[model samples]
Target: MGEISIKTEIPGPIARALLERKEKNVPAGPFNTVKTFAAKGEGALLTDVDGNTFIDFAGAIGTLNAGHCPPNVVKALQAQIHAYLHPCFHVMMYEPYIELAETLNRLVPGSHAKKTFFLSSGAEAVENAVKIARKFTGRKGIISFERGFHGRTYMAMSLTSKVRPYKYGFGPFAPETYKWPYPDYYRSGGLDPAELDEALLSSFETFFLNEVSPDDVAAVIMEPVQGEGGFIIPSKGFVQGVKKLCEQHGILFIADEIQTGFGRTGKMFAVEHFEVVPDIMTMSKSIAAGLPLSAVTGRAEIMDSAGIGEIGGTYGGSPLGCVAAIEVIQMIQNDGLLEQALKIGEAFQACFDVLSSRFGQIGQIRSLGAMCAIEFVQDKTGKRPNQPIVQEILRNAHQRGLVIMSAGLYGNVVRLLVPLVISDSQLDEGLGVLEDVIIQCCQNQQ
Candidate 1:
């Protein structure tokens, strides 16, 4: 794993064949097809059909927290598969489904009376959260932050801020949903570079009052670290400021921790890094160790407002997923993986910091544990995305037998989400390869 191994030219022959076949049939805009082949993953690395092994950084979009095909998760699925496949929790009320709910209620950030229910994806959880908020608050307007990415489903996409790809051409979205400036220092006007903390929070408070009449809003949704917009971090007073605003308005505060949960940000949840707690939280991605599962955990009174049979689905809390989650949470607790994520995050920072310092193209290097990203720019002053350079690096990285992902609204940020199960040696090897590609790409930049 130390040295770069390029046995075949990137996609190789087998991968190319698969992609050519897929391109004729699959929807092109759904996802950017990179390798022309699917992954056969084990731990931190993925082997393509070409037999080229890549130090994977995708982590299956953060769903493989326990690593691809962890022995325990596999065992749990095997155990559950024989027990029963579907009893439909809404009707039969199985043990693992209810047990997983209890686990989520206990684990998610918030000391209030908690209740949990399963959903199919982050979107369903988000939509249900809004439904619960409206039912509880008896209000119409829902407030979300700019540059926030909730999900891709119809309702979730409407709540999401980016209009170009997510909302464009998909007209007539959900109504009464409002957006305010998130504490994005790079873009939003609220943050004053010259001013101190007290003054900055006041500026944001002023914007909230002027923009959205607080009473009209039912819930205020926020991502602790703005994920897709840009890896934007709040200036210390920001999230707390928003929390106070929500309290004043009697609006429920919902944290979309789908991306930030399960030790991605080096904590159980990113909200754990902040002092204030959210009224409701939605989670997916890594909760059940690669199974299709999502949950909305919130205060008992709020979630209970929805009548029975109002919030459920056919495959929301699959027995297999529940079993996987039970084991995954145990692994997190027993193996001390939360602390390990912090350690790994430090390693990520060590490498990302070096790359950012060495290259002028690296505009900003932001990381909170393993959820790390580096934004690329053509010039320091403009801070505009250098898309060509980003694409080249991704292309070459694959060629060099390393796999990484490019994200952000502008598609100029390189996020490194290597699975937490990656061994120290494998992590080191991946980092070394990334450093070389970044350094080489920057050196050749015109």
Candidate 2:
């Protein structure tokens, strides 16, 4: 079956009309990647209202690792709808909620006695994790990495590093949040990787002396792979060092796996790759196949710090989301999605590695499993970010039936989060469109 079927000029007629309606009603704050509205989504493909099908490389911003509307997830949701909708965990307990909690407790990267709780969004999970960390350690300060992004809520935003889009006017954020440098070997300015790591690690001690006392810090939250901060990946040594620093102090280590969890990195959790078990972990994005579910899994004792009524929400761990998440975990485990992620990463590297040599703008091609990105620069020597090239490439790719997105602090990175369920042929086709668009755009600049 043909994967990409572009019948109209992107928005076409029907989509343009809908776009008019959206522009009138929907506020500009909520961003849209694809100009056209989705009529249907299946596997890794999305069909627009105008009947244009796009090979989705964005995967709903890493929320569909099991693919769009996966059969198992949909089946589970259908069955759940018949049973009941919400019987919120707070009002009346549901079996699926307990089942999901048990599943996450068993699966998340820790052998210790762990507890899990649910929320409606990634921000909520992060907020609750911070609360738990503070309650458990009785500390006021929380630390996150420089390029890391947690969420948009107050506490998460305070921890988040990106200031422009996420935290521009939203001032007077949650207090006692600090930022530390995460290693970016690609941008280390000719310094050795180990040297850069040591410098960054050493800065933490300096930070404790000058900025805030380590004893006052409750937790150091990190995205195993920085998602919104351009899919930046840190070394295992760096991650271990941060964990050790947290241990040196009384601070807990919180692995923010919102974008890197559930077999996205060829592992159940990204912390597995680092060989570090976090005291607390925040998870969302792909948890329930776009069911708007997030979770905070942690050491049982730490989680128990908050009394019964202090935690949880009205819509936390809804029955449908829980059932869907259980199915998602099963699908990733049983359906070879972890290996599939590896295959996608290998294919992406093979396709982009050659381009990196051909074009001076291609600064680096990076991936940890299917989470891949190509950082563009003006030249190899200076490595000035070439954001225009990325914008052009994205524009051209969208016009040609490929849905891709950009990332990075400078917005010069083309990040690919293709669904693991994408067929080899569909993957090849999407890559072809992207490759052609890149060549055309880069060649034009050259």
Candidate 3:
């Protein structure tokens, strides 16, 4: 009766055949949330090969803010394919690339003279942003926060904070990258938010003395809302404080809005929430409505620091990606997705708040607009991460036709990256499935 329709087991006959084929052909390195291939997707609904319909709450790991295969995006891609797929921007130089650059320059915060360049993925953007920062500032060191998830390239990996899955066995990372403490207020061991902010901000001076000098630091790359770090939202003061430190020390503040940009956080970009403009911003996940496009937008002077042919790839800013991104920007602006994001966040918070009251294991419910997450703990007092419970909940939700994913270092946080365009009924139905699963799982645990 609801949006979910489970006609067969999760990995049905067709899916099982494909999975066996996938195992033979594909490497095991790539991770998958649900063990099924998608046949079709629209808005917030995805149907697998098994004929099971799921309410998509993961949104392709937050890449489908405009929802899967948006008609406008598909139409744009179709037209672009007929005209030309990739003229190779370096060789021919396309109009779509220039147009997308102009649009991002106008939209991505700050009224200053700005420029934008595109890449194929968020990691590529991060690598280039670091290169630009180093070139512009004439510095070698970069500082990233604890539990941050930058891309997996050598330079981006060095800047990333996670070790087990992202960094382990792939060491000999790029040098001069350092990690700083990012505030996790929920797990702050009774420290006041203001006190924690002040401590971390002040510790920068000590860090400069102890580890690396501030003058040698090229930039401090940060996620406006730490995506892989459990959707951790830093206080406005904390963000401003870091920016102030960057300005004082002549270090660029690079905002990694890859997961928080394009109406995901109710704002055009998550940096807008803090009212602090970043020197450079890396955006990707939801930027192109699922096209493999990422962008680095910043002040013209800083962006121009890289010499001709210094920072670019063969497929960087492909014509298809450029056109898709252009349409995506238009959709975000004109389709009421921004307002819809706020509504989704409100709905998620209301649902989670009720569940939290009933379940003490719900440690923290946090969001910046639709970028919402519910952290599960062992108990109310101890606040130990409950990874087992999260795993059970996700498994149960999947069986019942809700697609969700777990985040956080301990994998105890259930993150909701539901599409902004999801209908009210679909949203409720998805939440209902999640709620029922959580109740059942918790009761069983007890």
Candidate 4:
């Protein structure tokens, strides 16, 4: 526990002062996992204003896969800053922007001739991808999966799945956006995984007949591994089946890789795990290592459907974000973070396998590479979501100096988005803290 030093309580003297100022100034709409303020960060560790150090498992909500302030990214950002900052891609184009675009074009799944453009956020990328899809296909409808999260922007929110926090009281959302069911095999109540996949895939044709026609749909947007939807992993057959349906219907398949991209899932992109290639992809979160950069990459012909000057922003492709992203990609490729992701997943699974056997509250522990989650239930037989226990575990874990957060539509899942670069010892320590906390919390419920 050397890396985790809880010298003072979570919101110790200094943090309490900061929190007072924050409560007075900042809006409650913006949520925070850790109640304290960050003083500094390195790799997978974050130091708070009260002099407490924590093993960060949230990874800034999947935005710091390269870890906080990676040396190469920081060095590159410093050099770019010394030279110049944003000249605004809309007015004066820069070379780093083109360079990063080329890198994504080659790296982001699909060997076909592709084109890439920049945006300031994941929502912007989704918005532009939707625009490109509509312009290319000249259709009006879009389809997203149940329990999946896109973003907070109007169109992205329309595609998102969760309510209460994300979508409650926010309507009326954009029109023509539809929801499709993504598979959750653990909760399928004894249904065979293959059967579930087949049923969901075959139901698409019936859906078209009952709802919107296939020809009227412009695109189907899906998260390769539903991140905000409780880290739900669908069968490869299901994903490929969706792609096949799109191919047959002349609708574009848009993979939203915002939280699952950049080595979060063993591979550079999660779509590779399913062996399905998307026509268009929206990427962000770890793209620039939290520099607020996103990309929309697609088939050259389709991306070009939007005439020049139709898609762009004032700070779309800032030089700093581009340089940081370039270094981030190179860092992932050269530094062996992909393999690290697999190792983290293995460690988490191994640790939780025993815990799940002992604790009936643990409904499931699942992972695809480093994107891992533990679903809490009332009991083994019922499998009713135990959201209260999840809340207790989160609070205890935070007090114990392990920074983590909860997810799932019902808010009963504890998701781990640990930075891929975390050392084995740090990972073990963090998991140990989480394990002890879960045991105590579950026992209390009993």
Q: Provide the lowest-lDDT 10-residue window in model 3.
A: 437-446
Q: What is the C-alpha RMSD of each candidate to the true structure, in Å?
A: 2.1, 0.8, 0.8, 0.7
Q: Higher lDDT: candidate 1 or 3? A: 3
The runs of at least 3 residues in candidate 3 whose Cα sits more than 4 Å from the true structure, single-residue gaps closed, are none
* Residue pairs that clash (backbone atoms under 3 angstroms), model 1: none
lDDT score at residue 313, model 2, on the 0-100 scale: 93
Candidate no. 2 TM-score: 0.99
The 10-residue segment of model 2 with minimum total lDDT is: 1-10
Report how far off residue 317 is in candidate 3 (Å).
0.8
Model 2 bad stretches (over 4 Å) = none
**lDDT of model 1 at residue 121?**
87
Ranking by lDDT: 4, 3, 2, 1
Better of 1 and 2 by lDDT: 2
Give per-model TM-scores. Answer: 0.95, 0.99, 0.99, 0.99
Question: How many pairs of residues collide in each model?
Answer: 0, 0, 0, 0
Best prediction by lDDT: 4
CA lDDT of 332 in candidate 3?
86
The ten-residue window of minimal lDDT in model 4 covers 1-10
What is the lDDT of every predicted structure here?
A: 0.81, 0.92, 0.93, 0.94
Query: Which has the better TM-score: candidate 1, or candidate 3?
Result: 3
**Candidate 1 accuracy as TM-score:** 0.95
